[model samples]
Target: MFRFFLLSIVCLITIPGFAQFPESKPEDEPFLDIGVALRFNYNLSTWKEDQLERGGDFGFDIFRINVLAAYKGIKLNAEYRHYAEGFGGGMLKQGWFQYDFSEASQIQVGLNQVPFGIQQYNSNNWFFNMTYYVGFEDDHDMGIKYIRDTGRWKWQAAYYKSAEDLVFSAAEGSPDRYSYDILGRNKENNQLDFKVVRRLGDSLAHELGISTQGGLLYNLDTEENGTRYAGAIHYEYKTGHSLWNIKLQAMFYRINPEYAPGNNLNFVEMGAYGANYNVANKGEIYTAGIAYHIPLETRLLQGITLYNNYGYYNKRVSGFENSHMNVLGALWTAGPMYIYTDAAFGYNQPWLGPEWENAFTAGTPGDTDWHMRFNINLGYYF
Candidate 1:
């Protein structure tokens, strides 16, 4: 099955006229383009009583299909994702339309990916892999957003519905009602982001960004009727052949007493797969990282690049320990394809660990541990 899909993808790229859209010869005519990517991975560790579990493998980890059409002042865009799991497992990730009001402003409406950060929209950008806060989740709720870009300033605001029911309260022995007050409201949650970039010289530039989200409601096994708020700042600078970026974010939340009384346990489960304990309280996290890139000038790999990054996160409320991550990688562009590889190391202090022994230990679930992953991908743009 994997081989057949792989061959089909290769043929689509090699076969001319596969992109059946008409060419855009006139400025007023609508235009269309397509993009595809194929990825694979092999695990090095196996699950066992004394070793980490392995045996997870995938081919064409992601198959993306994009369509863009524009005519007059209206624009339409759609994207689909097909995983190796099969056709039924595929999903319509993004479909949206936008109307241009002027050179500096536009309004977009549809079921589209929210634009909360640069990482949220462009995870495939070469620089994204080098950062710890890449916002890898592409979750999109039905919504609309407005964006304004003028000179050095840019901003965007969006409102979306919660993807699931809002739980008001819960505990190991008790249950509560699921709130549906905002079920039909388009603005169940709101997000705002802004940034300003300035050029200091021919070889130097800088940018600052602010992002915030609120009005999120969630009901869990321990907490009921919870609310979440977050704020983040990002800074970047570029000089010569090197670039640098840093990000800091913090969050506060409220939950029913059945969980805890403060903000510590909100959104800290590592993408939705962590154990739930009703220790309600407030929590704050501070994270920062830096990345450097070097471009090779050789004729065979002129676009080759190297990157490295390290990030640290601290939580103040949930008994959760502080964690850190380090990553290094490289990319080489070969004609219409690019080759890339990355390795990451992470460590954390468990609540029971000594001050100097916070680094994660092997052979324990939810314990501090380290892992390394590598990937080789082929991507094309039209």
Candidate 2:
């Protein structure tokens, strides 16, 4: 099934070396590393008049701190971000503690990444794929996870007791977060997530996997529990040591909320990044992305990754419209400084347009025009 899809879409791009903590040697003792990063951004969006009049707007974006430590058999990873006040105040990306049961198995607790989708991410762009808006990609929840790795097979199983919510969710001020999650009257709870990946090829050039998550949607209105489920199959490939990366995934997701009588059943409240919005109860999303890395030898320049990613959402409900997002972007790296320039185009996407309401759920049918945001982000890590 996937063999044909992989062959047909073996187009472009690949994952780059993500920031990783140094591993402790068998004979070594405990070690700790802390790093800091400051990122700035310039944006040209059609929706912002102040930005358009000036040809764009430039300012500080975020400052983040990372901590990684390992001792004996225990390990730790965490990051904290301080964004501009306009983008909410501060947020914790993830903070998890793990205990290794040999190299093949381990367990983690605290706010952890959900074991779903193509590992941690798909596209290298700043906005990620459209699935991010629907509370799927790069999602983290207060949970516990068990992981096992052996041969060509890898597995992850997690139980998220509840979606990440600090303070009051439905209160006046919503949560400012790094990942989208269910918020408002209906909350997410007792989610069970499991994923299995198999690496194929002599050099582990190909990866195939499936992921599924199911949980209860607890409604504050009715004081009853509904249900939600998401399932997806993904395929990824690389040319061992080459500069290209390819990833494709198809996902089906749905939410059945038992709201109080007369409440809106078609949409659920989803929030992230200091905001709240409605998301369709059911939808199917498809994502495909490609990128290529070009390494340059120079004093001021190092490497650049040129890539394109596309995502589509087809809702299974009426009075709702479909959505599409396509991002053409590049990532440039020079020492501790990294730059991301992207021309992101979208149809009915909230972040991309004048449609500020129901961009993910109801989708403005009148807003048929396409929107674009040209964004450049520069960050220096130390």
Clashing residue pairs, backbone N/CA/C < 3 A, model 2: 12-290, 12-291, 13-245, 13-290, 13-291, 13-292, 14-245
Which lDDT values do the candidates have, in the order given? 0.42, 0.82
Q: What value of lDDT does candidate 2 attain over all alpha carbons?
A: 0.82
Which 10-residue window of candidate 2 scores lowest in summed lDDT? 2-11
Indicate the TM-score of model 1.
0.63
- The TM-score values for the models, in the order shown, are 0.63, 0.92
**Residue-by-residue lDDT tens digits, candidate 1, 247-289:** 3333333322223446333333211111111211233334343
Those runs of model 2 whose alpha carbons end farther than 4 Å from true positions after fitting are 1-19, 26-28, 168-173
Compare the candidates by lDDT and give the number of the best one: 2
| Model 1 per-residue lDDT at 59 | 52
TM-score of 2: 0.92
